[model samples]
Target: MTDTSERPRADLRRAPERYLSRPEEGIETRHAFSFSGHYDPKNTHFGALLACNEETLAAGAGFDEHRHRDTEILTWVVEGALAHRDSDGHAGVVRPGMVQHLSAGSGVSHTERNIGGAEGPVRFVQMWLQPDAFDAEPAYGLRRVDPAQGGLTLLASGMARDEDGEALRLRRSDAALWLVRAGAWQPLPELPSAPFRYAHLTAGSVGYRTVPGPQGGGRSMAPGDSVRITGAAFADPVAGEDGAELLLWEMHSPVSYG
Candidate 1:
């Protein structure tokens, strides 16, 4: 594994604190929201990982007609429904318990909207991955997984595997994303020892006990909270509340990229 000093620091939160004072971005038509920014490349302590802030869109809100190039955009809807329309002419509604993926290889135009119809709020997590190679071709996909699906379900990966099955095939990188829901913990399978792990909580709470390095120690995470654990084993959850959900990513080491 690469030196732990090269990785980001780890801290636990029962729930991510809301910084209401930040400026909001209009990401779609008649829609605007704040980003819990871990987005900048320089701010990322390891590999090509970048995470956005938690977003809560008011009813009838969303971004429209934006363009992206050479990045892998992944979204996890925490609550309510998110409507996605893309240049690929793909449009759909993603509700709780679903993951939306867009590989903006060369470039792609897209928009995201909160379809709550002015009834309630919509919350979710959006992340960007720096691809090993850029400007290939754009692609889109999603996986609707139930919390009872337990263990790991591949949302997007560089290779094919049959464990929990694969959803979207990504560009050139050995990175793989796994989604875990409530009930029964599963140990992370053998992976390159130097990889970096990013864990994002979408709902309820999960306890990570005695993981390696900074990720070690008991930490409780609720929705909107995220932790970056470099080269650590996916520890079995010692305990959980009713609606726990997690998104885990195994990425190439910083040493490899450096």
Candidate 2:
């Protein structure tokens, strides 16, 4: 059952505080929410998001075929390349600056592996979102982005405002994913107002602050850090000296499995 009895107003989750899982040699994962054997009833989900995982796979290692249904899976590669193959006859190589989305409508089976020719270990962040409708046709989408370009780029969305052909389409209308790659000391764009918002730092550091709320204190966020905002807005984050890459989610509501 979906847990909605208790929820935080807003909070920061640091990198080291995440749940660590090393299912096999050369494969490491850090989960932001309850997953696999790390279950937290109060922390089962935030907004429509169910899982936010940071994964690293050594050369020639990867996840075997797995099945999923009624979930929207999004992946962002941090370094190296990820090779994907699925039951729907879709195959591709996703690298940094690319967005990969898989919609497990009714059901789908897939496998992900670090490319054998990668220079080193492959690292990526993968997130799962609950879909609004079930048993629809499965689909796949891939898009390459120029992170150096200024401003927030719409990566995936199901909202009416994003009906344009720019973003990968999702099956849920209450959520959207955005990306920002800022230069050193650059101010980020204003975030979209929503009941629930989550920001994950995929690369570099930033000075961030939540606005119009008790958790308004300025904070520094390193790679793997995340901020969860509920019924509040966030001030524009400033990139650190080394710059920053962020993946932000704007959701109007939490997940409901009725």
Winner by TM-score: 2
Give the per-residue lDDT digits (tens) of candidate 1, residues 64-135: 588999778888777788889999898878887778888898899998788846487787877777777777
After TM-score superposition, what is the CA distance of residue 248 in candidate 2 from its true location, in Å? 0.1
For candidate 1, the lDDT comes to: 0.62
Which parts of model 1 are misplaced by more than 4 Å? Answer: 1-42, 116-118, 146-150, 160-165, 184-194, 210-216, 233-236, 255-258
Off by over 4 Å in 2: 1-8, 147-149, 213-215
Q: Against the correct fold, how does model 2 do in TM-score?
A: 0.93
TM-score of each: 0.75, 0.93
Could you give candidate 2's per-residue lDDT for residues 196-254 as a string of tens digits? Answer: 88899998898866565455777788999998877654565799999888999999888
- Candidate lDDT (C-alpha), each: 0.62, 0.87
